[model samples]
Target: MSNSGMAIRPVLWDGDVFRVLDQRLLPHKEHYIDCDTSDKAIRAIKNMAVRGAPAVGLTGAAAVALGAREIDARDVDTFMKKFDRLCDRVKRARPTGYNLEWAVEQMRLVVVENLSIGIDAIVEKLREKSEALINEDIEVNRAIGAWGKDVIPAEGAVLTYCNAGGLATGGYGTALGVIRAAWEEGKKFHVFACETRPYLQGSRLTMFELLKEGIPATLITDNAAGFLMQKKKINVVVVGADRITANGDVANKIGTYSLAVLAKTHNIPFYVAAPRSTIDPMKSRGDQIPIEERPGREITHLGGKAIAPAGTEALYLAFDVTPSRYVSGIITEVGIITRPYTRNIRLALQKEAGK
Candidate 1:
């Protein structure tokens, strides 16, 4: 019940200014970016200053509120037009994460429903809604942790990719939340954090969170996951999702699919922990989801220094999809949805909606 050890808050809004922990400078620098305008907020998301699905979404909601406050509309019709454009811009800031669009839509709904209240009231409501999202995300993540803690073995190694921790969400995390919950419940287990290449979020952010929480963890190269799995060092795989399709295909950091494959081959339970908002009902399968290709410089350089030849060409696909069949279970705040994901995912989402 006490998250005293998990003292990281990646996103924060204090009425007027939107602030985000610049994740790009993590482990080395703990800098926070003050986004006073919507453009600044969107830039933070694009530059990876504020990242991870849930964090991005929470920031997007705040960005909408910031934009709404700046709009000089006198009437409902004028406000609605400007608000629509603002939401579209925020949604396009990052195409891969469903949470961004979801959060924007949530703010948009508040605007639509409050049309009778005038522009000033709507702007105030937007601010309130954004703050509410921050609280809701933390609560949802805790619920996910509660449901997923049982999946973690009492004494073993749990493999996780990327930086799904307090750094990845409003407060607590999705996948890391499960591990944290298990740890809090007195489960003895070690964590194998993949040093996700190009970005190194696991090495920088995940390691930072684990150490801060006093959880036992080891850092490993992304490629070393299979070697450890083969040796039976890993008991389970739990990672966060950027987007999940209706059929239960998961889109996460680029190397997630590989880890899922390795976990499946090793006969380890591969779990995807995420909030219900991460699920995209619009996409029936993984292939239908749009994959965001990042700048090639991300692949060609490290720490602002070129690691390859001047003319070297590289591809940077930010994310990859893991088919539902490889997943042992899809962990959500509602519960763990197992095989026959199409049916179970639908049922689980409906259950969440009812709540």
Candidate 2:
């Protein structure tokens, strides 16, 4: 996913020991750690080496598909059992992002749906289908960017929280893609990047990515968004969604809800840039969106540096939900959707989903 005219990010491959841009080394050393085993992949996902709902989901499916290749199965039923176990294992790695679990379940459904095909063929198709899912994300994100670009002001500042860029997707990113498209269209705008707490994905990843593209951006402490709003440093608050409920409520980075609130008080436009896949029509509202409770170590330390006394337990939440009512618009790859997204958005997505 290219944000602000950066570059294309490749999808996870079997032989490719999927390396995560060690978020811990960010703002200093931009490093990527290689994940070679299911164990390594599990650790990476747990450690936030690989995150973002879409990326994690893709990785979970890829990990299972690759793990299936390693299973020494003598028969089709054995392969099925082993593969099911593998998916279950990946599902346990992270339970917050329903996407990860959802993808695994989806892959399983694919396997079950095509059960008529032998295990040998099933394995091959899983790999093929998983690869296609990654490709589909890129295409969807690109379209979302194209569509989101129209909603952004021609010349104004845009605000975002957390990391939603090439590093966060199998290809084109949702929120970052919109920024990239706008930048490419000769739009001169400053990007206000919030330094998300616990894990500063914005300070570490988002800022680094924008700098790579030489885009103009300002770094602000997550709490300072309200001040920025009062000062009128921002015109729009654009965030990426981990999940969007049927009512259009969005689950995103922890600080996103605060930003949405600030934007609402300041009367600024708040938008959610995501692909149709991010929307969960099954859930009725934000109350159903699960929040990721992170390890306490994140709050007590900044990267590898200690910011608190030794062994200080800290409360950490990886996500928060912004009520749909607070959102001005939802910028999807398809287009900008307004309130009452009920029937239209779902119908459109259902059509795209082949439902």
Best-fitting candidate, scored by TM-score: 1
The CA lDDT of each predicted structure is 0.92, 0.78
Candidate 1 RMSD to the correct structure? 1.4
Q: Give me the displacement of residue 347 in model 2, in angstroms.
A: 1.6
Per-residue lDDT of candidate 1, residues 1-355 (tens digit):
2473247689998558889999999898998999999999999999999889999999999989999998988788988998899999999999998999999999999988989988888999999999999988888888899999999999998999998888899989999999999999999999999999889999999999998888999999999999999999999999999999999999999999999998888899999999989999989999998999998999999999999999988999999999999998988989998979889888988894325
- For 122-208, candidate 2 gives per-residue lDDT tens digits of 878877877788777777777778888876777889998898876678756778888888887888999999988877789888888
Candidate number achieving the greatest lDDT relative to the actual structure: 1
Worst 10 residues of 2 by lDDT: 1-10
TM-score of 1: 0.98
